[model samples]
Target: MAHDALRDELATLTTEAADAALDDIDLVPTLEAARRMNAADRSVPAAIEPCLPAVAEAADRIAAAFARGGRLVYVGAGTPGRLGVLDASECPPTFGTDPSQVVGVIAGGDVALTTAVEGAEDDEAAAVHDLDALGLTADDVVVGISASGRTPYVLAAIREARRRSATTVSVACNAGSAAGRLADIAIDVVVGPEFIAGSTRLKAGTAQKLVCNMLTTLAMVRRHKTYGNRMVDVRATNEKLVARAFSLVQDVTGAPDAEVSAALEACDGEVKTAIAMLLTGVSADVARSRLAEADGSLRAVL
Candidate 1:
């Protein structure tokens, strides 16, 4: 069979390669194999340790852009793409960010999120098309993700972002990947060999998810999305969250439940505003102004 350029390189690797060892193992018991895989997975965090500084730097850049009204965009394919979308989608409910503020671009568009699209990742032009649709600018931050570190679609997106003077970062499992070379800041967490041999969804996926979580969560934290450790800016859309809002008010002010309830009502169930009202003993309007001045960070006002 004629191998694809990407697969050609992948096929040349021995068991020594990070993603090929699993196929060679047969003597181990099923339970033991699973246990070993679990144990091996712990090394993923350690693999990422060296890149924390880079990750933090990227977070700083992203936070600065977002503070200035720029968007954070995540682009990828397969598992990496899905993870990007997951992180971006959570920003709204978690930090009360607008849907457009954080966006995710998959190779085959939204459809690829659920099902694989044939040759979708190979189309470099599609990457630019997606970025163009978003009206990308220098104020934006584009993050490209790929486990093998050689996906054309991801590389194209990063290159396009950089060409437009946008801050570009690439997250990959393999070192020296093309995507890494093109990014302004490249994060390569080498989680050495997959348990299932070339199945990046295992350890590689775990590392990527961890990094993605840090990238966005830390950016939000830097932007004053939380008060102390509590998610003060969380959007209360459901019963559990509404209850959480009341609890947060009580926790921040150490006030009686009745007073907390009153503050929440006054602020229309906005946790940050409710906390500000309870602590400052001011009207909701005044509390809102103070919170706004504080960048919606509850701890800042206190």
Candidate 2:
């Protein structure tokens, strides 16, 4: 894109506009500046409220894809790209999903996560290459995240994803986004101008993170990754999480510490199986069979 054309495009986006109200932000005291930024951040959730239905719909589509042995792939640039990676990385430890189950692709690849890659977001062909490397399939769901909704890389990624018959979702902080038009599901949270003009890493970044949280969290919940409010599928990889698992098992079964420890050991520290064994007085093998029969839903088995 030419500089003139790009400038014209940016002029039309609400997110790119400068807020005259914040022109004096730098002149204010440090505390006042922080307050102003916090106040700006607080509006992000309300802006997203109107987009919940769209978010829920996208999440359900993601859950359906997962059930079909598909994956949830997030594609974006810059801060949005980093947010996608962060969300995808948390899935394994949080919900016991394979690393391949949730994927994140940035315009410039892994190196971009730490350092900026100049003009990478404008290379639309790179976006197609990244998705192709994933062996894009019809069963997968791809989400394009771009604050301006006009990002060339994200637009290309969404288009490529749709071309492959994969479910496509667009998440942006602007109305009438190009990405939104290309996606099957459009989630646009129009939060207006940012605290710092044209810097989307602030309000836009926060909003994207929150939206991604809902997408991944609810999708896992729908797939029986949790047993009610507890993370029954949590991978106890560390001391804190192992502790959490023990407390979670005991809390759900009302079992004594010794009994919970025994059940956990018997079930190989699998929270759902341990809870099942303790609550029903069943052996670990029987509990595992029951859980499998119940489609991994503890509530159903109970």
Candidate 3:
């Protein structure tokens, strides 16, 4: 009385799934296999090149919304989710952006960030709930990350975001994915079959991370977070960052360390203002005004 129908359905579902059985392969050659895996990773960037236009478009839209005081929200599951959270968390110290300006929403919430959540990615309704919790509006930008591009949670999140009139971008490894279709902009970096087959954390994850870096970094650059290629807006929260700020000021204005220190003191340790004061030979207040007029871009005022 075996359930043949259920057995067949399970088999069909797993038919194309990547085989995790590598035990039969010779044990001593495993290091060679890992090397080959690393070699395969090199193709990920090439795969992502064609999608740069789409990625850039998304970045431009994100910058616009951000300039208008909208938030940038990242939604994903598993590794992709963790990557989004990591990127969002770094924005504050890296670009001096408010923590609330960038947000990360994982499928199973905070706990899932550290541990796997059974069936969390299958919860379609949960995505809507997460968006609701954020009070998403038309001014927001939502980026959904999913290697397979079929995760119900991510797809539903992007769909809901779009319905709310928010800008939605989908980052995926597979072409023609549901996540892509549901988003306003789709960046599909087809890195081919994974080295371990379907183990997307290898190639797909790398591509997603790279794209995420580009998206956020380029947006910050557009927002004038950098001045003359230096992170002028960086939050000098530690001794290391304070030293970095001093070095950046000295490098930008060709001033001695003593002058840099004086300028920093005048600007209350604000790197951008200090650089402005040093380069423009003005008081801190006048330097602040010049920087404000140039939208905090050193290149513009210099």
Winner by lDDT between candidate 3 and candidate 2: 2
lDDT, candidate 3, 1-302, per-residue tens: 35796455333332124545443345648787776677878988999999999989999999999889999999999999999999999999999899999999999999999999999998999999999999999999999999888788999999899899999999988777668988999998888766665577888899999999999999999998997578998888999999999998888789988899999998888888888788878999998888779877777877
Ten contiguous residues with the weakest lDDT in model 3? 9-18
Give per-candidate clash totals: 2, 0, 0
Worst 10 contiguous positions by lDDT, candidate 1:
12-21
TM-scores for candidates 1 onward, in order: 0.94, 0.98, 0.91
Query: lDDT: which candidate is best?
Result: 2
List per-prediction Cα lDDT, in the order shown: 0.88, 0.94, 0.87
lDDT of 1: 0.88
- Tens-digit lDDT track for model 1 on 1-302? 54685567775432126444455457878887787788989899999999999999999999999989999999999999999999999999898889999998999988998899999989999999999999999999999999988888999999899899999999998877667889999998888777877788888899999999999999999999987688888899999988887787788789998898888888788888888887778999998888788777678777
lDDT of 2 by residue, 271-295 (tens): 9999989888899999999998987
Clashes of 2: 0
